[model samples]
Target: MAGSLWYATAAPGPVLGPLTASVRAEVAIIGAGYTGLSAALRLAEAGRDVVVLEALEVGERASGLNGGQVIPGVKHDPDILEEMFGPVAGSRLVDTVASGPDVVFDLIRKYEIACAATRTGWIQPATSPATLEVIAARVGQWRRRGADVELLSAAETARLIGSQRYLGAWIDRRGGTIQPLSYVRGLARAARGAGARIFSQSPATDLEETHSEWRIQTPQGSVVSAMVIIATDAYTDRLVDPLRRTLIPVPSFQVATEPICDELRQTILPEGQSASDTWHLLRYFRLDPTGRLVMGSRGTFADVPVAVAARHHYRAVREIFPQLEGIRYEYHWGGLVGMTRDHLPHLHEIAPGLLTGLGYNGRGVAMATVMGRILADWALGMPGPELAFPVTPLAPIPMHRFNQFGARMVIQGLRAMDGLARVRDRWSARSAPGLSL
Candidate 1:
């Protein structure tokens, strides 16, 4: 795996204890990424005995390798969510994910975690007239719900994003950015401080229900608990066949330039808002604490040279901001994003005493942390009817291996279409007036 900017710059995490013997806890969580660590913190703070078993060190997966944009809400808009899940459940779901950034920043302030959190905002810039309409609908829905969101004109969008490539954008003030690796490690530290036992290098080899309690078998130890929470999103393995099959892991790649001069830093992402364009194969860009321009996009499913993998991102920076020319990239990394068929995050009670919360699409930083709290709530006896998000059965996609293979071709096709759309929109802007909401 490539070393990410987060791993290269974030503070070192606490050393975890080894799991060499059998242990019993009220709840056992698998995969100590954002979800598991978040749940463990809440559970231990609530005076429950929680044990977390991680395959590797904390934040070694998506939680640590992500773009660090703490974007609020899922892929679907608020009204669409209500229509899809029905009025009551839909409304609750809307409120839950819409406050995702609040959940993350609140945890940071509460725990005093030093992750370089910035709440300037998150921007979704439109690449063409069609995407401009999509963002307009989203802004209207959110504004009606009393969210602090606004629509930006072409000039305003260009100012904040430091790019003339976008015609406009929708800004959500509640969204922000953070040092993701440091944040996840901070969560682990807080969970341990609150009386949770976390063990690293402990992969849950097998999980089975013996009698009424669940036993998770690892290499050198086992955990017997009444409730089991599978927080492993994209890194899920064969420990539970049905749960793993329910998600498709799509690889997202990112690269960061070496810290630029003060002049360049002041001109790019001037207000500190992270922005991702509206495209089928979208590209996101942000500035790290030290002024490194971080660009993220899709990476190939198969391994290739670092330069080859980061080729698209390099082109993005050049096309969007000509001033960034001659800047050298310093870091490149990739991680799998758990994408669902419907693009909605799934919460499943796969079996008695076994539950999972995954398929965050690309909004793992905020949504995954929200899932942790929800998982803790469910373990604390929250009934299904009272929960905001609906819990459904795991419906594994047919020919899962085939879908993963086919996604690569689909990504290439989208890339071509996106390029054409960009060129068309740029020509349209030069020929006539730009589009409006």
Candidate 2:
């Protein structure tokens, strides 16, 4: 079931009976993931009649099949944005993202959502010397931008992570983790409770623009709405062709162990913070409330397992924690991340009465939830720059359909280069003259 884990290992109690006939609504939202459901909740709360069309069920794709990392802010670094667009505009963007988590938390609390929400924070661990430098710089940049962040030394990092493989880490209290599927499903429930109509197992096949209204056709019915929001992310490529071209689908995989030793659980991530290494192809791991070590990483493997992409995650997890060697991986799964060419989110005003927001580049958990609220506000005629990200929509990658080959090549090449750098750093540490070496 697409939303099984999200509804706490049970399938979404028979998706809201499908839309069997024509309906009219103030807004029709396509895709019932975090973005769509969150927006539905917001719009419904404001007394607007909203209808959500989901292909399968709420949180069916990446929204539910993700690492559950509730990261704060947009994917791009502030310094990079500053260089591209001057400090003023860049600062504002950074400021908005810095406050995004609070907005999401407020909605969760207000709606009384039960997604096992936790604010235990997150740590950016450095796997190599170069990575340490980058993490240190990011910590400084975030601090200067008024984020509650700090860079930790190797000793402190080890104390926090119980792993000597990392050289240092960047700690931030703003970020956290969640049971992603649960959060989005909870949002759907909240939206319904607020008087929104959600039709699951219904995909918006055709979007018709008629006399200033948007008509979305599903399998068995249609919704004529004053406004429409395309909140599918990776799934948007199906209905919107240009979106498929602009947003590259990158696959991310995860695996979960049955449970670790009690001693290991007590020592490693006991406080429950989500942790990821500072690598382009990163490894993220966190323990569940039940002590299962759920681990994830970038890149696909040749062999796919029956359970949640287990083998790929197993290899990556073992590399970091050799103690877990030969352990059985009980849960395995994979999902596609809608990665933009420039590694930023996409917010497009496709036409009057129709808007689309997608391409979160793997940070969709909080970003999608927060963006949903903003998109709902935009549909209600909220004016200002906050409704959308300012970057002009660029042309899709040349021959984007052929990008799978390119993405694979780039990932493998980067991993090789990073491996070489790690070797050099290790050799240098062993050869140092005066100190312990």
**Residues 136-239, candidate 2, lDDT per residue (tens digit)?**
77888888878888998999888787677788898889988778777777788889999999998888889888988888898999999889998988766557
Question: Which candidate's TM-score is highest?
Answer: 1
Name the regions of candidate 2 deviating beyond 4 angstroms.
1-15, 301-309, 384-388, 419-437
lDDT of 1 by residue, 32-78 (tens): 99999999998999999999999988999999999999998988888
Runs in model 1 deviating more than 4 A are 423-437
Q: Give the alpha-carbon lDDT of every model.
A: 0.88, 0.75
Residue 30 Cα positional deviation in candidate 2, in Å, after optimal superposition: 0.4
Q: Candidate 1: TM-score?
A: 0.96
Under the 3 Å rule for N, CA and C atoms, how many clashes does model 2 have? 5
Q: Which prediction has the highest lDDT against the true structure?
A: 1
Could you tell me how far off, in angstroms, the CA of residue 73 lies in candidate 2 after the best superposition? 1.9
How displaced is residue 150 in candidate 2, in Å? 1.0
